[model samples]
Target: MERFFKLKEKGTDVRTEVMAGLTTFMTMAYILAVNPAILGTTGMDSGAVFTATAVASAIASFCMALFANLPFVLSAGMGLNAYFAYTVVAGMGYSWELALTAVFAEGIIFILLSLTNVREAIFNAIPATLKYGVSVGIGLFICFIGLQNAHIAVDSSTLVTIFSFNNSIKNGTFQSEGITVVLALLGILITGYLVIRGVKGNMLIGIFATWLLGIICQIAGLYVPDPDHGFYSLIPSGILSAPASLAPTFLKFDFASAFAHPLDFFSILFAFLFVDVFDTLGTLIGCASKADMLDEDGKLPEIKGALLADSIGTVVGSCLGTSTITTFVESSAGITEGGRSGLTAVVSGIFFLLALFFSPIFLAIPSFATAPALVIVGFLMIQQVVKVQWDDLLEAIPAYVAIFAMPFLYSISEGISLGIISYVILHVAAGKSKEVTPLMYVLAVLFILKYIAL
Candidate 1:
């Protein structure tokens, strides 16, 4: 194991890697249940999705370990899956099978890009300020998502509002509600305190603490189930069961149907490819930095292999009836636990496979429990904001737009699009056109066309 993973070279041992792996799994295990619930809305079988989620995650994480020697764990990405279900299937009137085909196409393109080192060139093209901004933007996006999942930030008619029973009393209900808000707050307090004290696996500890408290709320009749809004009463039917059958969703992609509308299909393919490319690059750089894994030139080592592993994961996941699989930002949790080698990913992969048999235990963990980890991760990621050169308006403006637009507009691609277009326009208008890269101009034009098509 030591020779295979180069444990000494990475300055980590098997015990530390195992602990980090468990910590990473605990922080991200929420996906096993959430993926199924979200995708099931599109007429896919929930059980099949649950099975595919575990199997795909295991395969992806294992590949990352063996191929790239990176600690990052790959899973069905959260934002991409939501886009597949709601935007592609329900809104755009495409079938789920066709959406899978689009994802498959995206994977093939990504694999080609990685093989040719085209993806690495694109990563190099992004401005340093915008790259840092992407980290902060994703951090804010993660926090916003956590707030919504925990019911601490509720959507009003026009904007997001803090959910408080006291605030809501004047409008309708006389009695107090919004138990999720209280639960999330408690979770934040506990996790924050534990982190301050330098506790190992603090996020994992905080998740279980919040989950137990939520169960207590259920006993007191305060916890309520609202399936439409994604709230569950923390109930479970049993403790153990056989893994769900994967026959329904396995290899369900419809290649012929997906290619029927060539233009629209190409546009859809671009959306998937664009998002996956930036998201993976951003995540790899951000998380690897946390582990001090970047080279002296500030580039991730063996990046092509990492990209290839991720591309392979997405392709295989599509065949297995899941959304695009990518390296998760939650792997930062493992890095925080002293994970510095591929051994961490290997152990996490094993845990994911084992989780297939213990679905009931993991599935019962409520959104509020995992919400705290997401919020804490957002805090960790936003630390990159300090690295931005705030005094230069030319650089600062685009970075600021990218940071705010992510959570506000609810689209990473949109935020990146606005940032790229504005950056090029501002540089050219200011007679600093020489600073703008040729690729940036091409991206700006493509983004403009993308918005026009919408």
Candidate 2:
């Protein structure tokens, strides 16, 4: 292990790597519950999604270990999954099978780009401020999703409003909606406190703790199961269960259907590719920097292998019926714990594989329980807002538009579209056309045409 992973040179040991990997797994394990919940909203089988999530995560992380020899782990990305389910399938009204095909295509494109300088050029083409905006926008979008899942934000005459305990009281359904909302709020507080205390795996602990509380409420008769209204039993049928069959979602791509809608297919493909490229690059850079793994050029070593691992993960995940898999920023948790080699990733991957056997535990976790983790993760992602050059209106305005457009418009692609178009137009209007990259101009024109033509 020492010779293979260069533990002595990297100043880390097998034990340290093992601990770091476990730390990484604990930190990110919330996705085992959250991914299925998010994707299940798109009519996918929750059990199958749970299985797919675990299997895809394990495969991707293992690839990260063996291919890149980096400490990074991979999984179906949070925002990309949202774009797949909410934007492509729900908003654009595409079948989930076709959406999978787009993901498969994106992965193939990523593989090509990873083999050349094209990916780097595209990464450099987008302004850093806009990248920060996209991150913040996705953060807000995820937080909004958490709120909706918990029913903390409910539909109203004004379009959105808080869940009303008073209304539930009058309607005598307080045991269902009101209690769940209250528990969700309490879960947020609990999770926030855990974060404040600098707890490792705070989000995961928050999820389990909140879920346990709900179970207690059900036992105490304070919260009642209303399967008719989407509430169901919180208790697992058993503590141990076999992994669900992936037959429901496995290898379910509909390439023909996707290709028939050429324009829409490419649009969805671009959205998946654009977000996955930047998100994976950003995460790798951030985590590598945290681990002091970058060279003098501020670039990660073995990045091609890393990108290949990530792209391959996406393709494999799509084939296994999941969304785009990418390097996770949560791997930074392991990095902070002295993980500097792929052994750490290998350990995390092992944990993911082991998680497959615990499907009942993960699946029994309700959306409300996972809601706090999503909100907390969103808060973590939103911290990138500080990196944006807020003083420069040219940069800030487009960033702002992108940031708000996502949750407001309820579409990640729309947010990217408006952000790029506004950025290019504002720069040209201000006689700063020289500052805009040729690629940016092309993207802006394409997005403009997308709106006009599609």
Candidate 3:
């Protein structure tokens, strides 16, 4: 294992890798509940989607381990699933099977792009300053996600507001929502303290400790299970269960129906391709930057393998009855936990497979428990902000745009697109057009066209 993973070379060991993997899986396991719920709205079987999510995630992570030797995990992506369910199936009046066909097509195209170095070229083309901005932007983006998951940031007239305990206080009855918010806050403090103390497996410990506290609160009747309000029992209902059959969604593609609407099918395919490319690239740049895995040229070594893993995972996921699978940003949780080798990915893949039988236990881990780890990891990632060349306005201005656009626009691809567009325009406007690469000009034009046309 050491020889294969270069554990010693990477300055990590078996125990640390194992803990990092577990931390990453725990933080990201919310996808098990979330993906099914989102895709179920399209009339697909939730059980089938759950099964596919686990199997596809495991396959992709293993691919990362074997092919790329990088500590990255892959799963059915959040926004892509939303596009699959709401935009394609519901809004466009397309069948779920047809949508799957579009995803499958996109994956095939991605594979070709990876093989031909198209994706790798794009990764290398982005300036180092923008790459740093992408890292910092993703950090803030992740922190925002953690806040939302814990309900610490609630929707309000101002767009977002902190959770309020006033209603429960006035009624003199503890509510699940208020309890979760409080526990999440406590969890953040506990996790932060553990990190400061240099606790081994601090992230994993924080998750379990927060969860144990919630279980205790539930037992004391202070926290109630309110499925309607997104709060559930902290204790597992069962130790194990049979994995759900994939028959309902397996190999369920409708290419004939999809091709009948040629224009619409092409549009859907393009959307999947464009978003998956940029999202995967942004995540790779951000997480790789966080792990110090980028080369002197701001390019990740063995990147083609990572892109191939993601592309293949998307194809396999679509065949297995899920949306496009791609490298997850949550992998930063493991990276922040000192995971620098593929052994971490291997361990994560094994846990994803284990989740099939231990769904009850894994699913019982509430979002509040894992929110702290993400928040902490986000803090770690943002330290890269100081590396940006702030004095160079030409670089600094575009980097700033990319950094803020991610969390505010809620899309990594959107942030990169706007950043590239701004970068090219700024360089050209300043008569420094020689600094912009030809590929970058093409990318900027394409992104602008994407906004206007798609």
Candidate 4:
């Protein structure tokens, strides 16, 4: 195992890798329930989605370990799945199958881009300042997701809101009334404390601790359990079960219908492709940086392999009945756990496969448990902000735009698009037009056309 994974060379051992893998899995296992919940609203079978989520995540992470030999895990992304179900299917009136077809098309495009130098060129063209910004932005984005998932930060109709502690004390929402916001707070505190004290596998310990507390609260009637509701209720039931049939959503893409309208078809395809591309780029850079895997030039080695793993995963996921498959930002938690070799990804893949049969056991872990890991990861990632040159407006403003736009707009693609466009304009206005590459101009125009299409 050491020879295969180069464990000594990477300065990590099997035990550390295994711990990192478990840490990564615990932080992201919420997707098992969350993906099915979101996609189920679009007519896909919940059982099928559950199976697809596990299978796709396993396959993608397996490829990342075997092919790319990197400590990255891939799964169906949170934001794009929402775009697929809500924006494409519900809002645009397209069929779910048609949306899958678009994902498949995007995967094909990604593969081609990876095969050529196009993908690498784009990754290299992204300035270091913007790269640092992307890292910090993704950190904030992950924290926002953690808070929202835990229901600690509630969103009003127009703006995002937070749970009221005063209200919790004085006849405000609790247990049956609220989504266990106090539990989430406790989780954050416990996990943050462990992380600050440099505890090994702090994230996993925090999650399990929080989950145990949740169960205690449920039994004590301080937290009500709702097994029949669509939401995840932290209710524990059976430990293991047979894997669900994937027949409902497997290979269900309707390419014929998706291609019926050329303009809209290509537009949707571009949306998926662009979003997947930049999302992968941002995540790869961010996680690799955390692992100290980047070279002196701030470039990821074997990046094409990593990108191809993602592209291939997306295609396989489309065939198996899910949305786009991409490297997760949550993998930062694993990197933080001393994972530097592909063995980390391999262990994570194994955990995902195991989830296929023992899903209920894994799913029983409440969002409040996992949310703390994400919050701590956000803190870890945002430290890159110190590397940015804050004195230069030409660089600072664009970097800040990239950093803040992600959480504000709720889309990594949109944030990157805005950042790239701003970067080009700022450099050009400052008589440094020569600094902007040809790829930047192309991306700026494409992003403009993309928004115009909407």
Query: Which candidate achieves the best lDDT against the true structure?
Result: 3
- Model 2 lDDT on a 0 to 1 scale: 0.81
Clashing pairs in 4: none
RMSD of each: 2.7, 4.7, 0.9, 2.0
- Can you write out model 1's per-residue Cα lDDT over 325-352, one digit (the tens) per residue? 9988888878877788888888888988
Candidate 4 contains a number of clashing pairs equal to 0
Largest TM-score belongs to which candidate? Answer: 3
> Model 3 over residues 1-454: C-alpha lDDT tens digits?
9999999988999998998898889988999989999999999999999999999999999999888999999999999999999999999999999999999999999999999999999999999999999999999999999999998988899999888788656368878888888899999999999999999888889989999999999999989898887788899999898899999999999989876889899999999999999999999999999999998989898799999999999999999999999999999999988988888888888998999999999989999999988888889889999989999999999999999999999999999999999999999999999999999999999999999996
**C-alpha lDDT values of all predictions:** 0.83, 0.81, 0.93, 0.86
lDDT, model 3, position 304: 93
- State residue 101's C-alpha deviation in candidate 4, in Å: 1.6
Residue-level error in angstroms, candidate 4, position 290:
1.9
Estimated TM-score for each candidate? 0.91, 0.76, 0.99, 0.95
Clashes of 1: 0
Q: How well does candidate 3 match the true structure, expressed as C-alpha RMSD?
A: 0.9
Against the true structure, candidate 2 reaches a TM-score of 0.76
- Between prediction 3 and prediction 4, the one with superior lDDT is 3
RMSD of 4: 2.0
Between candidates 1 and 3, the one scoring higher on TM-score is: 3
Question: Candidate 4 versus the native: TM-score?
Answer: 0.95
Score candidate 3 by TM-score against the native: 0.99
Q: 81-171, model 4: which lDDT tens digit per residue?
A: 9999999989999988998899988998889999997898888888888888888898998899889878778767758888755655535
In model 2, which runs have C-alpha deviations exceeding 4 angstroms?
1-50, 65-103, 170-173, 246-306, 322-348
> What lDDT does candidate 1 reach at residue 383?
91
